[model samples]
Target: MRRLYGHDAVDIEVATDTQRSRVADVLLTHPITQRRVAFEVQYAQLSVAEWRDRHESYVQQGIIDVWLWGHTRIRRARSEYALEPYRLDDVQDELRKAGMRVTFINPESSQLAIAVNRFGRTYSLASEREVDLVAFELESIRLSDQGVRSDAIDPFVTAAREREAALRERELEAQEHAEARAAIEAARAKKASARDLERARAAREQFASMPARVDARSGVVRPSVTMPARVLCRQCGKPLDATLAEFGVHLGPCRWEQERLL
Candidate 1:
């Protein structure tokens, strides 16, 4: 620790001024920023509530606390929903919510390992959902207001953010497509309705223009009525007058059907 930061003011198990007696495992004061950082090596199982309480204590005194969990302690936390062979640490999520950083160091190897969440992809195998731990040197650790900031995790964090942005963009595009389709369908329906209304108006005008005609059956003089007219059939070669137009169907046989009628 003295060789890395050139800080001769490193102390072990130091007490800070607070309402409650707060002891930090290892404390080092930054020479330039005058900021103090406390490093806590957690070997035993610690509950989230207890961890939060301790973290809050340091925060009250304006001290940055960095936590390094024992490998077995961290590995014990497993996700219930995720498949076997890969398990997420629920404690990590809680720590993230408080803007805290976490790392795992085995007693045997004494190497630093960072666990990062995977995003923007599908995981088919159970092992794929497992914790992905990247090993980095302790030299990468830097002190920040948020806690110990490391460049080792920067790539993973950036990738996750990019994936989230891409997903949001895709959703927006899909919504736009649905709205456009609805608009096009409404326009088409409106056009068809207008065309039908124009056709009916023209038919009415053609009927009203005809001269008076005699009724074939009763020999009565019938006045021309301003009603819609329709062609009986293509082969019949005549449109129905006002009285017969209401039927809309061919009453008499056309040349094509005359042979069948006989």
Candidate 2:
């Protein structure tokens, strides 16, 4: 502690109160802000209740409480068959649910490690990684109502936001493409309608200019009407069989030839 901070900035086994006092393992006072941070190193298995009691005690005195657990209390996840220390996952989860911090420090290497889930990511099993302790110490000056907050470097939230934005952009592009196709289809349908109308008008004129047909049985001249011609009946104002009408021998009443016009 003295090497990390200055000689006067660190204190050992500081008592919070005179009677029924709670002792801090190591107290570090910031030289500028004068904010106090108490670090408690626990190697033995400590229950959630006992840890909470000690943590709350420091908070009540306006001191930031930082807990560093050894392998017996919290260990890294491993897959190989080897003797490993039992880690208290349930205890850590309960504390985290109450917005308390859970961290680990290797007793031999003194390396600090934090859970990967705290960075807003997940895995099949719980995993952790060693963090830069100097950066964490500098950022620890920022406080919350609980006196201390998790200072893990977070990037997952930013990545998630970027992904959501990209999805929305793609959806918008798809909607625009559908609307463009519909517009093109509507224009094509209008052009086809106009062309059909023009063809119908041309068919009407073609029928009027056709030469008169001669009846074989009566040997009389008559206007010819067929499936490909368009001639209107003077009586019904519909298509008429001109040859039958001229001969006064109507085979059938006149009807419009819609297919020929188109």
For candidate 2, write residues 198-233 as lDDT tens digits.
Answer: 998887778777765433343434454464433444
Best by lDDT: 1
lDDT of each: 0.65, 0.56
In terms of lDDT, model 2 sits at: 0.56
Collision pairs in model 2: none
TM-score for each candidate, following the candidate numbering: 0.54, 0.43
| Model 2 TM | 0.43
Candidate 1 structure quality by residue, lDDT tens digits, 108-201: 7656776655443631111232555676777676766655666876665566556657779999999999999999999999999999999989
The worst-scoring run of ten residues by lDDT in candidate 1 lies at 120-129
Best by TM-score: 1
Error of 1 at 239 (Å): 31
